[model samples]
Target: MRNNEMHEAGQGVLEDGHGRRFYYLRLSVTDACNFRCDYCLPEGYRARAGEAAPLSVAEAATAMRAFARLGTRKVRLSGGEPSLRADLPDIIAAARNTPGIRRVAVTSNGYKLPKVIDEWRRSGLDQLNISIDSLDAAEFARITGHDCLPRIRTGIDRALELGVQTKVNAVLLSDGATERLQQFLDWLRDTPVTLRFIELMQTGDNRDYFASNHLRGDTIERQLIESGWQLLPRAIDAGPAREYAHPDYRGSIGLITPYSRDFCQSCNRLRVSAQGKLHLCLFADAGLDLREEIRRGDVAALAERIQTLVGGKAASHYLQQGQTGATRNLSVIGG
Candidate 1:
């Protein structure tokens, strides 16, 4: 039987005190990115002089094994930009080889995708999530501080050709969001990829930027619905996006409205930083150190530690209250 089917047949599951079960794990492979997106890292990524390196191949494997054994079926490798890792393919293979991990995915900026995507796919990458904030080349460059949108587009086409499940993420900004939406929808009329519009969130370092650029996701959601897009039911292991499909378009749209009411009620995923700390919520006040258990190489202890930590997860993130917790910036936790 397929590993996912076996997991569905009643294996152990990870549940928090609020009774939410986790089936997805977003693991950061590194905290460094090449992009200087305005909402994320406006000045680009700088390596900390005395910071410890990210998890080793064996350590990543151990963490994945523990989660898989506890009913986590999907593992997404994230980062400030995950593709920056020279050994990312090795990490992908390790996750794929885990006994109960049914899917291995990666979220990248697509800066190096054109060159290394084939290697990643061969290493068992089942899904790819690329960030393409704007469809206009000039505006894209303005936002991402890179004039390589053409190259990123080429890599996306390559991913499509490889039959990799592809999704594109765009941050909704008050400036020109309407125009960007029109461009995205026009492109989606033919492209079969899923385009996800994420609401601009307020991180500790991005307060002023957030205040200036934040756009409510519901406005876009309402517009799509009015245009006859049908809301689709979420999959058992889906992320927090509410997806919609249009009869005349090949692509689908997903809205990630974190500030919307009850947004956290469907939370089914957890994050672990590249530094080996567990974050119960993206905006939580602190992270629990899991590197110690990983260093001991004790799977049982690691699993127990994870479960104990998860049980203390708060019912919801206080984003509406403008509380951003320990997330000084998105890059720190691979948001």
Candidate 2:
């Protein structure tokens, strides 16, 4: 977009009282996930009775346009599994078609990438983030209740071949972490992908799981530095991960340490739920509904509501206070 248009669109609402400017949006396409991950949905996803259907392709596109007008440069399509949505390619095209949006990304469980990744790339996908919690086949099955590691690996390879920027997200657990980290590092030595180790976060429904599996990423960061892995400078639009690189390794490592002090100070993203609710924070008490404006096809009203709601965003989430407000599980908002 032209500088003048960006100036007008940003009319100062995208920046909060804390002076943070949001340039990224994580938009969930659905809350229903197929994987029965131990940390997220141990019993698997069951649709909530009477819950509104997820935003349609047009609705999602409208919301993206509104955010694009408000200076959002990147949009990441997320879900319990975004690939589960049949119109995912349309959503990807929508983001790519937006004037101000420069990148379109998706986060999925990689269950269907082998079959649909090529189509996704043809539809204008620029980046991919797939969940691969464990490299060990048996452990992967134990964690995700799916014995499809080989298939997922094939999908990752295809993504690499397609020249898409790909990243793997792994939830770091305390159980045998040393061995797990070794496996990850060994794989990264020859794989040209970014492997991110996300510290297990506490949620409303995972107190016991959190207490048992949560691992501090700070220790991992220190280890990386000691082992000659150089920390890379974060870009302005980067996500929460602190990335590192090593000369001997083909791929890189990223540590997402949400519990660290001042973790939210550099926040630069907002979330929109599948039902068209603007979430100020992943752990916010509730979201501001924008379905009405979206349904009316009123971009101005949608943007206005988003700006108004964003102005009241808290300085930081209260996860440090041992409170997970509205998020009952990671799948709820595609965390």
Show model 2 residue runs off by greater than 4 Å.
1-13
* Cα-based lDDT at residue 198, candidate 1: 96
Candidate 1 lDDT for residue 234: 99
RMSD to native, candidate 2: 1.7
Query: What is the lDDT of every predicted structure here?
Result: 0.91, 0.90
Off by over 4 Å in 1: 1-10
Cα lDDT, model 1, residue 219: 97
Please, what are the lDDT tens digits per residue for candidate 2 over residues 116-221? 9999999999999999998999999999999999999999999999999999999989998899899999999999999999989898888999998889999888
Worst 10 residues of 1 by lDDT: 3-12
Candidate 1 local lDDT, 1-335, one digit each (tens): 79654643226689999999999999999999999999988988888799878999899988887787678889999998988889999999999888778889999999999999999999999999999999999999999999999999999999999999999999999999889999999999999899999999999889999999999999999999999999999987888999999999999999999999999999999999998999999999998999999888887688878988999999989999998999988888778
Error of 1 at 156 (Å): 0.6
